[model samples]
Target chain A: MKIREVTLSTTPNAEAVADLRLGDIIYLDGLIYTAREGVYMRALEQKANIPMELPSQSAANFHCSPAAVIREDGSFDLGAVTATASFRFAKWLPEWMAKTGARLIIGKGGMSSKDYNEYFVPNGAVYLSTVGYGTGALLGRGVETVEAVHWHEELGIAQAMWVIRARRMGPFIVASNLQGECLFERENAKISENLDRVYEGTKPAVLKRYGETDDRSDEVIG
Target chain B: MISLDLIQTTAETLMDKAAIEIPQDYLDGLRAAAATEDGDLSSFVLQAMLENYEAAKEDRRAMCGDTGVPRWFVKMGNDARVEGGFVALEAALRRATANATTGVPLRPNRVHPLWRTDHNNNVGIGAPEIEYGFEPEGEWMDLITVHKGGLFGTDYRMLFPSDGIEGIKRFYLDSLVAFGKRGLACQPAIIGIGLGGSKDTCMVLGKRASVLRTVGSRNSDPKIAAMEDEFKELGNSIGMGAMGFVGKNMVIDCNIEVGYCHTGGMQMSVHAFCLSSRRAVARIFPDGRVEHRTDPNWFTDYQRRETIEWDPAREAAE
Candidate 1:
């Protein structure tokens, strides 16, 4: 399908997401949150029930803003900013999902199949990753500072939330999703096959020197 | 002698906010893409560019590497003359260039090709690569200097001549496939390409063209943009999928640069970099005036190529 960019200028959040596919590049502009990984993990350690008003659904997006997504007009209503990373909360996500109704996790990649299966469907959350090291490109999208970052003073850069304006925030693929349809598997199948081929063809001399006979050949060719 | 403070502070400020003035067309193509594009990676990549802007503002760091190698595009007025010395004025400008290197910790970029030794990354040896043009009629001289970033080191790759392929897109797709086959995507990187020059220069121009782009800039020519559009479509159609996972699309954006080429015998090549295509560009004015075009109309909405001929069923019915 055409890469989708829907302007989710809904009630509590005015965010946009790319109608994501297996592959597409996205740049987000407009408001988002920054969930420092260290601070969030600490929250989990304390068994803290940090609160929010607009807790997300499996379909909603997680943004990197300093402020919680709030009523467009500003009231008690708020939205759950996606955690910075999903696996960063591997231990915490299952419990967090049961309570919060948060669906989206946006950051860099890497999540296990088990994580994708459990909390994702039960809690209706999807894990998304932002572009890696494209900080400069992301900055060009512009930032709207809504809330000054707030956290326990000692928390330092961790745990503080600053609502921001994200530009082109998505079109991010959930390499792993509640549904078995994973972006990671489809993308890497060809690669894995090719690697197996190379390994199987490894030279006998090279394998002897490295003490690395091909395991792939024994499994497949045999 | 030019005062020490003047040299230090002026070049410092100029280096920062240097890429800000790039035409919106460039940024509009790649950066502004945030506003459009449906693919997840496309939006995310666009977001990363947006962050570049934010960091520049918060830290007040140059948007992308001191607006790249600072050199003035000068048009001197007939009446304009130095009061004390021409060489001294140029020398003072040179000194300011010296201070910029330390202040920015800019990569030691420039080196002689023949001698192959390091030059202080100075605007020396015509290093800033100055070009002078006097208006045939006008009195006022216009000087614009751009600081091009030096994103050199190991990221260089070459595009093969088309081998009778249709256009640049095939070359780009081939590069992405090769990179995937090599496991380069395990790290974050973008493929940068330059086409139409000689084997070496064409590749160099590709990398350099990326610098011309603001953190998220795109090619200006409509034809090039169309090719980019086609590139994305072909990529997605092939099912490489995001992260090579689901769809045919593997690349976030296949940025390509081209010089004029023959209609019958177009030369195309590839340069793929793993995830971090760290790039930046800048400009400087001889009179200390500078600006960059921040946006441009670069890529168009993803368009499936229009079917040229009527379908067999439709033809039969007609």
Candidate 2:
């Protein structure tokens, strides 16, 4: 199958986001920013002023921390770029999208369809999952330069907000679309159809832990 | 005595190599998987990862940004000695870890668990865990560095003796399917299983089985080796490929490590070494001859010795 690929701006228009389909590959341009628990807690919870102008400067919020460092002379030596799992950040995402007008939520795993329907669709946002999940070097090649890093002193490099200029920085898969459909969930349903056959000879453990589910289709993430 | 300077410098080089270079054994396994993978999305992911490795090598950058938590495994020959005692050697390893964190421009991934303080050097209390193993003879020391991603793709369970191979199979499938969803565990990985040890040792054995052993290597016991082959085939049959898409390449290989446990209880652990499977090894002699290679050769006969004494002739005969 010839997978569709598209180039999009970090600050994309509604039409562009609406045009995205589940499983479509994306290459991003313009400005993008990295934020995870540190940026969200500081901005949404502690009420620290957000460093960059959100949505205006960039609508793409990447759940990432690049392998980068600042030299003694105060220049950046940025290397591979990749994303962390996004499911853990679900709590703060709704507030973050409302606060920053984020259009693209890019990360490791896409969130649930419930997440996309409840807030992402309403906010005109969608989820883009990093491909291979280990394609950091490839993604790094797309990064033009590190524009700036915020809150490194306070939150450390892993959690700090890193603003970067992306030339064609991606191979992200459209994991969620404007209609709140989830690509991962759709794929899971297909794979689950054969779980019974694969697990035919296996027997449950004699001792079971509390809160353990035997259901093969149940996802560990919320 | 091996030079302290050589140990430290070699460790630094190992860190860089582990981060930037994908091991040949793993590369070969992945290529084999890519060739057999028929799922479109899964095939695309495999191809992209292949290209990612080349990009990392050409650019001298880390294969993955997470870079996992960097740790050291030191295996020494009985006759080998360090320039300084083990304390000084540990200090040198710690220094190398910190220096490489900035020099290689690695993300300073370590931090205070509660306070969330960042040393920005990947060094902190109990950070860069240094584990040691010793061999029977030879005046050489081996340094192995593994940068494995910390989160997801690992689990432990307590089972009774009644929970036989069938039970083991059940838990294995559970771990693969659970973390395999959405590619959380990073499928097409080296799946390691630890059995028969105490809870803690079970985790350690499984972890080592995943990161220490090379792809296609098998357990010494023919029975366990057969199980490894069967597990590898079973994992691939799950119909889930990379990113949990419908595919046929969930596991690149399966490794099982076992230890003697209490007769009443059986402890099990599962671990996945993901696509980047970053590991590098070097053997340094007392004369300062250093040999670098991808295979760690960690689980030698001495390591898996079942007898009370080191009887090489007896082991060889057996």
Candidate 3:
């Protein structure tokens, strides 16, 4: 069970992304930018100009908000970079990917296989899930510097687009690959095999909530 | 009287400690889990988290990027008094929260629900919620700060008495499996269950059980304590580990906190304290002496008193 670990550039090439297998650990170098809901809405819906030159400046779109601040002297102090759940951002990914030419979608949880097949595979993008649901300090150590922050005034710190220069940043798992296979789903299928045995003695609640599913195999997320 | 300056400064320190330090009890529980975790991916995650804890301490940075929502649980002895009263005490806590937001560089996570305004200081209306408790005696106050992740790994259900213990087990499993997938709930967490209180109190009890109580600590009730042990084993048997990978460790420990509810209904809530499990505590004496520790020691006998009167001597004698 020795897991293969690889180092990747933020602006990864097609062969690099295609070569990534599900479950391989990744360490990224080069530039990475934080972009979640705020950045999505502003760039996709509001038609606002993207602050950084995408794909050229960096192709890695990180779904994160670093524990960070701007000092009175207007310098940045960033710590513990971690990812948010990526499933919630599915709606805007296709458009964002096409527009930004992003090759890496890094975040907390991996997207569904359908999401991978639909746009991620077609766009030559793969999902990288942050290990430990975080390893914020370890990830923070990889940050060479906080290059810049965008939309702090309009979007606030949590949703601001933080551009960071990463030296060897990560411990991200290749949760999805060019083949549209999801590591999480593969693991989920294996775990679900024993659910009934673990739940043998338990009985369903007398009063069930609406829309509740007794299917242990089904994911809570879409 | 506990000086306002001391309270604020201690609170600021607690915030930093809570953010950066993995409480010892939780760290121990996690280490135990890591030892038994067989799944390769899951075991890797556990090891990385262990190293991350040391990195956070050495660098004085948050252990996790999502620092969670910071809140306070204030406990004071009946004889204890603050220098400027409770209003000023609250102001001091708020000031500390805002200061730490910048000082520790915590993400200013608070915002208006509808308007989505960020003060960039983790402070806003009803932000950094301050809940209070009073002990029967002593002239000291305890400040406990917990920075729990805001989203995922918590749920509430209304079950009638007829639902029985089997029903309770079902819902508990439901919560764990639901959030445990893809490590959304941050498995190997301290799972907290609240049973039999009003809906709000049930939520509060569950939350307190998860964040306030230390790992490996149990309920005062022997019967409930047994259930806690059973639930811990039950959770780990789920064949799921960190990030929903197949593994042997899903729960580090399980804690159940109960409150009396209506005769006809049983309200239940479940909460997970997450991988980082950030919490810090300090007890300040009226003499200006302050003590810092990891354990909150919140669920004392007085907190779970069953009778109408506060008579610790009689209870002890019994």
Candidate 4:
């Protein structure tokens, strides 16, 4: 059997950001955003601008950080983590990316998991994590600038949004875009395929529903 | 067979101890989660837990500064007799709490629900809430706590899912969303999953579960444990790794809890405690003995409470 080969599109950031070839694994070393609960929901309801924030010490010590890592696994660089587990305003992720042009995302703690498959897959953004109490590391880095997160002033804590020049961030990749060159998609697709197959191969469940044998005698002749 | 008074006393001691420490099983749970990890996010979370565990024990530090609301589990000996029943038990516990606080000063984290007020001493009218369960074999108590000396964050998302086992994942997830929405950063994170029981109990269980899960121990329940692993895997997949450090892990621990299943009429009621998923546990036995559980997994941490010797006649020996 002869199998034809196909090639994907290329981008200038590909080599610099180690961006995946829409299918190849690549390590990313660049700036990313952080967002969590309050900021997200408010944005969804009020359509307010907000920035992503990393987990604070309390959340870090208690909850896992919302980030992921990416590395090449053969020809593809699949994401290990996805969007933050605590999804806030994930619906606007595409819009956020459209505005920022930041191809990579760094949150996956609170958002509903399926958001990736639904919205993120269609968008160019890739999600991942650095979960588990990395509050100090997130904050200690030198900041370059920040965006709309400032609106929530009364809400004080460590897990806030800001963009900064990370000194030497590395081996970054977790859940990521499965739709294009991202590795998360492929892995997820593969798993889903296998699961589907298994589900198909299994026999039907033996139990009949409770109402299947309802007595016709009770029904009116009509 | 231990006496019922001994059991009640154990519960008293448990509450006092809980007010001051985090357990090791929780640390191990976070670490074990790294297996499903795919990047720096997962690794960083594991590392933070390890460091936190070290800091809490070696430096006598609290695992989490929040040191949340306090709760206890009293497993009484059915055959055993209480000198004066719950009244005596509660009185002794109150004394123990006061005595322990005078020196240990467990964080005063309880607040009046309606008034939104605080007592600051970690001791209020109903602080260190306790639950009584009579086990046929012997008397023992598991005092669990999360109380802080002062109220910290006041945001709604800051402490959602504060009630029960009803929808814990949603609560924790909501908290995560709030953190992002509020733009709080450098979050010293600790994850807790309160399962089983009604609202209040479930939340308390959540805090306890968080601190109790070892750095890398899986939940024994295959279904729930698998979910925990899946959560870590999915979280790591996102690359919210290492303090959202672009390569750090999104989570370190996914603490869990399992409550008693509802049995009969009025099935509407369910109770549980929060799993304050974090690292470090300081297990102090009845005879003033201290044993720390660092890992998040339930059984390990190289610790067991030493038996407290009881003189049959010397009740006043101190």
Query: Would you list the clashing residue pairs of candidate 2?
Result: none
| DockQ values of all predictions | 0.08, 0.88, 0.88, 0.05
lDDT digits (tens) for residues A112-202 of candidate 2: 9999999999999999999997798999999998899999888988898999999998799999999999999999999999999999988
| Model 4 ranges off by over 4 Å | A1-222, B1-22, B29-49, B113-118, B139-225, B242-248, B251-318
Encode model 1's per-residue lDDT on A62-113: one tens digit a residue. Answer: 4332212222354311211222334445666565556544445555444555
Model 4 lDDT per residue over B140-201, tens place? 33333333212211111112222222233333433432232211222323444554455555
Candidate 4 lDDT at B76 equals: 40
Give each prediction's root-mean-square deviation over alpha carbons: 15.4, 0.8, 0.8, 15.3
Better of 1 and 3 by lDDT: 3
Name the candidate, 1 or 4, with the larger lDDT value: 1
Error of 1 at B99 (Å): 17
Count steric clashes of candidate 2.
Answer: 0
TM-score of 2: 0.99
lDDT of each: 0.41, 0.93, 0.93, 0.37
lDDT for each residue of candidate 2 in B185-248, tens digit (9 for 90 to 100): 9878999999988999999999999999999999999999999999999999999999988899
* Overall local distance difference test of candidate 4: 0.37
Point out where model 2 deviates above 4 Å: none
